[model samples]
Target chain A: MSTIIDGLSLGSIYALIALGYTMVYGIAKMLNFAHGDIIMIGAYALFTMMNLTGSPIVAIITAIVVCTLLGIVIEKVAYKPLRGASPLAVLITAIGVSYLLQSVAQIIYGAKARPVTLFSLGTVKFGEVTLSLSALVTLIVCAVIMVGLTLFVKCTKIGRAMVAVSEDKAAAQLMGVNVNNIISITFAIGSCLAAFAAVFYLLQISATSPTLGSMPGIKAFTAAVIGGIGSIPGAMIGGILLGLIEKLCQSVTALSPYTTAIEFGILILILLVKPTGLLGRKRREKV
Target chain B: MSYMLETNNLGISFGGLKAVQDVNLKIEKNCLYGLIGPNGAGKTTLFNMLTGVYKPTTGSFSLDGENLTGLSQETINHKGIARTFQNIRLFNNMSVIRNVLVGLHNQPDFKCNPFVSMIHAKRHYENESNMRNRAKELLRIFDLEEERNNLACNLPYGKQRKLEIARALATNPKLLLLDEPAAGMNPQETAELMDTIRFIRDEFDLTVLLIEHDMSLVSGICDEITVLNFGTVLDHGSTRSVLANPEVIKAYLGD
Candidate 1:
């Protein structure tokens, strides 16, 4: 029971981050390799803001704003000019941007892990089962965000525009949708999610470092691939499933060290069975 | 002296090949105009330039006397030009109603801010319900209201074509471009589509320009026609006269 609760908390963090990946990929049709770096930047911003202001609310708001601006700037500066370029070229540029952000952070903050005070709600005991309040809070937050996102996409005009842009960019343009504006908005939303994920992540790990985002970033991406890269619900399911598997493995002493390998092995097995991921749509060429 | 849409020597070239050149067009407002030609006669190319899909290397075009040359596709669309592809390009994954809602996205009447939508404000709910109602009306006109919740890809071939037009009309375009809308339909479907086209033109008070290979459809509906051959205008006049032209017949029939 304890392991399941821990898994849910960890999975919520991965799900939050994976949404950023899936959304950008769905709308822009580009793998934003710099997305993980955006989370790192968010963490750093949170650390700096918390040190300066010492208020959790203010720190979160500042981190979100900073990451949002960074996301828009990165898109306009690094990704905009390469809009119609080949996937390989865009992929390379995204990787380059990721490294550039990491290097810039190293220069500004130095190569060190900064400790952050974890936000906790203590614990709640239900008879023999003890639930950490932070874990419960994370689960609730994740569920709320997922439901909110789903409703937003289904019920809103801009959300419909996002769906249109994702399915057929030219057709959407013909309908007078400013494709560039929509892309920028997508990036903004994605980075904002990354910031939120950063807050929850810091609450758990209690540290901030330049390379800290890479591990979870790769793991969330793996989760996205497992669920389906462009699918929203897929990310949620994949994240929770991965977290559960990882926690269960950690509970076994012999399998704990091999958890990452096991996660990747499952990914490979999934790819072999379903190349489009679990929830991915198979593209059929119209005659 | 003014036309709804006019092109002054509009042309484009790819490397050494002139896909279209030295073409001038004068399209009157609220009129059904036909552009017909053989395969590779630059018919689609002209449509492409008109809709700002491809920038012309030479000359200029205007809509309602406002110069709009060399603009982007989105800009042209905003300027009241909406088009359908030769190949149907509906938002295949979205529901039928959602496809039209996307077309209604930029309309001032249905505008709602992202923040307002996120919070589900009263105004947002009101605007959304209005938009959905409008989209449903469009679907009803195209006889697609029954499939409002069905994915666009699941619609039948003829219904898919109608849905595309319905989606375009939802944008409230002053000028509508149809590219071989009846390409894969049967005779009965094509006949029904012709009536729908004429009805929409009269009902919406729209000026329409279409490229077609179906002579029956063209002769049955087009008021004026322009025939092109080898990247240049071969004949231009009333439909009856242009269709009677020996040169126009030769260009099409290879006589």
Candidate 2:
């Protein structure tokens, strides 16, 4: 029970962050590979602001704002100019941006781990299982954001525009969609969500480092691909499944040493069984 | 006299191979114009130039007296000129109505707040539903209403072509450019499309320019026709006159 709850909490956060991946890919069809690093950047933003001001709320807001801006900048500088390039070019550029951010962060933050002071570790018990207040809060916040995101994509005009761009860029262009602006907005929103996910994860784990984003980022992308790369609901489901898998693997006495291996094994299994994903649909090229 | 669209000495060459050259045309307001020629007579290239896809080698194109030589395609589209490609390009994964809803999104008057857009904006909701209805109406008019919720990829080949035009009309352009409204359609489908084009023009109050090869549709529905051969205008006038011209006949059908 404890393992399930813990895995779910972490999985929820990964799912939230994976939305960033899936959403951006849904619109741009390019893997914003640097998206993982964006979460790291957000964590550091909170860390530096907290260190400077010692005010938790201020730190959170500052981190979110700065991360959002950084996301916009990354899109404008790194991704936007390379629009319409091959997936390989964009993917490599995303990796380059990830390295660039990691290096910049290491240089600035001194390459040491720091603890984030979330509102203290409190817990509530359900049946025999205990849930940390931070974990509970993370689940709640992620739920709210995911709900908002779902509605935004479903009910909003810009959201519809993003859908259109994803569907047929030329047709969207004919419809007067500023494809560039929409793509940039996609990155900004995805990055902002990644940052939010960083804060959520840090709240549960209470530590920060320049390289902290790497593992979580990979996990979230895996979740996204597992669920369905271009699907919103798929990301959520994939994330939960991945979290459960990770936890279930760790709980087994014989498999405890193979947690990472199990995570990878699931990915391999899913890919070999279904290339697109469990929920992923096939896409045909028109343009 | 003023024209809705004008291009002078407009031309483009693909590595010294002339794709379209010395092309000039004036689109008067609210006229349903047709550009017809053989399969490779640069009709698509000409459409590309007018819509700011390929830059002309040595000519100027203007929309509403605005110099469109350096403007981006988005800017040109924003200025109320929109186009569809010969290859049916719809957001394949997107729903049919959302594909059309994307047109109204080009205008960024909506507040960037996801909160407002998600809830409590009556105008946004109303306008959006209205837009959806409009798209539905278009699809229904084109006999695609039942497929509004389906992904664009599932549409039949002929319907996909019409959906592109419907999606294009969603942009609310003063001038609409259709690359080939009958690319993969049968003779019966092309005949129905001629009436559909006329209905779309009048209903939307749009000036239409189409690239087509179906001489029956062109001569029957086009107010005027321009023939291009080897990237140059071989003939231009009323459809009967141009089709009757020996130059057009020889270039298209051979001597």
Candidate 3:
């Protein structure tokens, strides 16, 4: 029971990150490889803001604003110009951006990992099952965000525009949708989610580093692929399942070191069985 | 007299290839105008230029006396020009109603802040319901109300074409461009479509420009016609005279 709770908490963080990945990929049709690095940048911003203001809420808000701006800038400067370029070229540029962000972080923060000051929300005990306050909070926040995002996409005009843009850019334009503005909005929302994920992620690990985002970033991406790359619910399911599996493996002493391998092995197996991922619909190209 | 759409010496060239050149067109308000041509006669290319899909290498065009040349496609759409592609390009994954709602997105009356939408505020709810009602009305007119919740890609071919027009109408366009709307329809469907086209022009008070290969449908509905051959206008006049022109017949049937 304790292990399951732990898994759920960890999975919630992965799900948050995966949501960003899936959304950008869905709307922009680009794998924003630097997305994980944005989480790192968010963590750094949070660390700096917390030190300056000594308030967790202020720090989180500042980090979100900063990361949102950064996401938009990165898109306008990097991705916008490459809109019609081949997918391979875009992928390479994304990789370049990831490295640039990491290098910039290293120049400012150095190579050492910095400990994050977590909010002392305290823990909860339900008989034999004990849940950390942060874990409980993470789960609630993740669920709320997921539901809110789903509703936003399903119910709102701007949300409908996003869906239309993703389906066909030219058609969306004819309907009076500014495709570039929509793409920027997608980046903003994805980066804002990354900032929130950074907070919970730091709370769980209690540490921050330039390279820290890379591991979790890759893991979250894996979760996205497992769930179906562009699906909202799929990301949640994949993240939680991955977290549970990892937690269960950690609970067994013998499988502790091999957990990463096992997770990837599962990813390979899932791909072989269902290349489009769990919730992904197969697209039929009209000839 | 001010025209609904006027292109003055409009043309575009790709390197040395003059795709569309020196095409001056005048379409009256509430007029049903037809653009008929052989394949590669640049009918679609002309439509593309009118909708701002391609920047004209020469000349200018205007909508209701407002110059719209060099503007972006979305801007042109916002200025009351909307179009459907030669190939049906509905938002395939979205529900039929949602496709119309997308066209309604830029309407100032339906605008709600993103934050308000997120919270499902009263303003957002009202705006949403209004847009939904409007979209439903459009779907109802197009006889697509029964399939309002179905994905657009799942709709039958003829219905899909109607939905595209419905979606375009949802934008509240003053000038509607239909590119070969009856391309794949049966005789019955094409006849029905012709009636729908005429009905919509009268009902919506819209000016329409369409490209078509179907002579019977074009002559059956279009009030005026322009025939193009080899990137230039061969004839422009009322439908009967234009269709009867020896030059137009030569363009269509060859020498």
Candidate 4:
């Protein structure tokens, strides 16, 4: 029971971050390799604002706003011009952006980890199971955001335009959708999710560092692929399943040390078995 | 009276190859214009230029006196032009209704905000219902109302073509461009598509430019016909005159 609770908290964070990967991939058809680094930036933003204001809400808002703007700027400057270029060129650019963020962080924050005091309202216990207040808050926040995201994609006009652009950019353009604006919005939404994920993650570990986003970012990407890279629900399901599996593995004494390797093995196996991921539709080219 | 659409010396090239060149056209309001040519005679290329898929290399065109040269495809579309592909390009994963809704992107924000939509707010609900109603009306015009919920890929080829036009029409365009819309249809479907095209032209009060290889379809419906050979207009006139022109016949058949 405790393991399930713990896994839920961790999975919520992964799910939040993985949404960024899935949405950008769905609309833009290019992986934002720098997406993971946005979480690190979000963490630092939170760290600085928390120290300045000593308020959780202010810090969270600052992190979200900073990441959202950063995402839009990166997309406009780096990715926009490469819209018609080959996918390989765009991919290399994404990786370049990732390394650039890391280098910038190194210059500013240095190599040492910074300690952060997490905001805690209170804790809730349900008969023999005691979970931290932060864990409960993370789960609730993730749930609201996920539901909100689904609604945004499914019910809104711009959201429908995103799906149309993903399907056929030229066709969507012919329909009068501003493809660039939709792409920028997709990045912004994904970055906002990343900002939230970073906050919950910092709460769990109580520290921030230049490299802090790497492991979680990679894991979230793995979660996205496991669920199906372009699928929103798949990200959530894949993340929770991955969290459960990791927790279960850790519970077993002999397998605990191999959890990372085991998770990666599962990713490789899924790729081999189903290249489209769980719910991803295989593209059918029309001649 | 001014032409609804006009082009002068409109052409494009790739390196030294003049893919299309030295073409002049004048289409009157609410006219159904047909462009026919042998494969590689640049019929689709002409459509590409007019639709702003490719900017003309050396000339210009206008719609309602507005120069369309050098505009992006979407900007041109916003200027009251809409088109479908030679090959169908429906949003295959989406429902027929959703595809039509996408076509209506420019309509006022019926209901949406990330936060409001997430909460299923009243305004959002009203906007979606309005959009759905609009999409349904378009589907009805194309006789696709019954399949509104089906995935686009699941539709038969004839229906898919109709759905594509339906989606295009949802943009509320003043001019409609159809590139070989009946390319794959059977004789019966083609006959029905002809009637449907004529009906929609009148019903929607739209100017239509179409590229078709089917002589019977073109001659039966087109108000004016233009024939192209080797990137230049070979002959253009009333359907009967152009079809009777030896140059058009010779262009279709080898020397």
Question: Across the candidates, what are chain A's individual TM-scores?
Answer: 0.98, 0.95, 0.97, 0.97
Clashing residue pairs for model 2? A167-B91, A168-B91
Better of 1 and 2 by DockQ: 1
Among the numbered candidates, top TM-score falls to: 1
Error of 1 at A96 (Å): 0.9
Please write out the lDDT profile of model 2 over residues A157-190, one tens digit for every residue. Answer: 7787887777667656656778888887888788
Candidate 3 lDDT, A39-98, residue by residue in tens: 999999988888888999999999999999999999999999999899999999999999
Please tell me the interface RMSD, in Å, for model 3: 0.7
Model 3: lDDT to the true structure: 0.92
**Per-residue lDDT tens digits of candidate 1, residues A107-213?**
99988999987466788999999988888888888889889999998889888899999999988988999999999998998899899889888888889888878
Candidate 1's TM-score reads 0.98
Q: Write the per-residue lDDT of candidate 4 for residues A58-167, one digit (tens) a residue.
A: 99899999999999999999999999899999999999999999889889988799988757656778887877778778888899889878878887887899889988
TM-score for all models, in order of appearance: 0.98, 0.94, 0.98, 0.97
Comparing 1 with 3 on lDDT, the higher-scoring candidate is 3
When just chain B is superposed on the true chain B, each candidate scores a TM-score of 0.98, 0.91, 0.99, 0.95
Q: In candidate 4 chain A, where is summed lDDT lowest over 10 consecutive residues?
A: A116-125
Model 2: docking quality category:
medium
